[model samples]
Target: MTSPENAPASRGPVVWYAALAVVMLLGVVAVVAARSSSNTVSNKVATAQTSKVKTGSSSKALPQLMDGKADAAIGQIIPAVSGKTLDGDAITIGPDGTSKVVVFVAHWCPHCQAEVPKIVGHLKDSPMPVGVKLLTVSTNVVKERGNYPPKAWLDRVGWTAPVMADSTDNAAATAYGLTSFPYFVVADAEGKVVTRVTGEISMDTFDQLVKAAETGKAPS
Candidate 1:
């Protein structure tokens, strides 16, 4: 028979063992929960990144030119224009002994948004000819507009052309006499303006403009 004092002592070890088991079980549960939560967060992050990549992937549709016409500025010397790129590199435009195709785009223009992907796709599929430098001028950036920030929009479209970020006053656009979005200006190796297209143009028109710029003549 156990004494009254022995009863408490006998129960003490059992209680301690049960308490320890409970604590261990809780610890294991907590660790498992934490790992599960971590995995969930990681999966969400991966899914978001994949979605962004898929959304920005290149399209296969060909582009078409519209309302294209030769400019009066044709045969005139292109202005010595300069601006910074999205990566903060200084870019100067003019006669650099190479034909240049300058594409002026606005972030807020729906037409520009539609045209950009097509241009990128066409350029990727069929690269520009040698001695032809393709450039883009990101202008008219407005926060409350169609695409919001211009830099992100360009990145989203996977624009790989040399970009010249226009100033707050749109100095580059003004220098080129831009009256509309998605404008195209082609200049010869000698910096002479060959032609200007006011709207989106097809790849054939793009090639024609480049050829015209190189030969110092407007596209027929």
Candidate 2:
């Protein structure tokens, strides 16, 4: 009943509409697939980049040293703490049946900045006695502060000690009851604390503390 020219015109409109609908559907599906793929990739990246920190339980926190009187932490076992190094290598500092002289330092502290080089130089001149392990903890890190990246600062000072990178929550510091920068904890072979000292100390004093750890005796 329809004329030929009019029939063709009607068919043309219907065909064009169907083609446009197909194209729109395909575009919507492509966008959805792309968004899902992007989310999956982002989740994988976040998981792979996460840093881990592990700390052991402590019965009592170390008392803050005031005028050389805080020896409460002495005779207590040093907490078993484990964390990663600057290069992402795993390390643990605990009672490993070896004497340990652990020093905790913050990159921004002036005293720590002055102390590291002296320790490094001393170690270079006189290595620690056999069976004694010297460990360093990089803590209280602030990217906006001076000596921002502790690894670079330590490397520049020719530090050869194994470093334990602390977490953002200062977990290692808290586990050890850190009260100040340039903190020292001397633990004997059984992991019992022999003594603790803070602030910059003379290498002679440092040697004495190391001796205390070696002998399992608290310094006088």
lDDT of 2 by residue, 1-220 (tens): 8788667545778889999999999999999999999887542211111135687665344555556565778788888888887657888989889999999999889999999999888988788999999998898888777765787777788888888888888888888888898999999999999998889999999999889989999778
Tens digits of per-residue lDDT, candidate 1, 1-220, equal 8778776445778889999999999999999999999887642211110000111122121122234543467667667666567667767766678888889898889889988899888878788888888998888776556555677777899989978777777766777778888899888898777888877777788778878877878877
Q: What lDDT does the true structure give each of the candidates?
A: 0.73, 0.83
Clashes of each: 2, 0
Candidate 1's TM-score reads: 0.67
Against the true structure, candidate 2 reaches a TM-score of 0.73
The runs of at least 3 residues in candidate 1 whose Cα sits more than 4 Å from the true structure, single-residue gaps closed, are: 1-70
All candidates' TM-scores?
A: 0.67, 0.73
- Candidate 2's displacement at residue 174, Å, is 0.8
Which pairs clash in the backbone of model 2?
none
Cα deviation of 41, candidate 2, in Å: 30
Report the backbone clash tally of model 1. 2
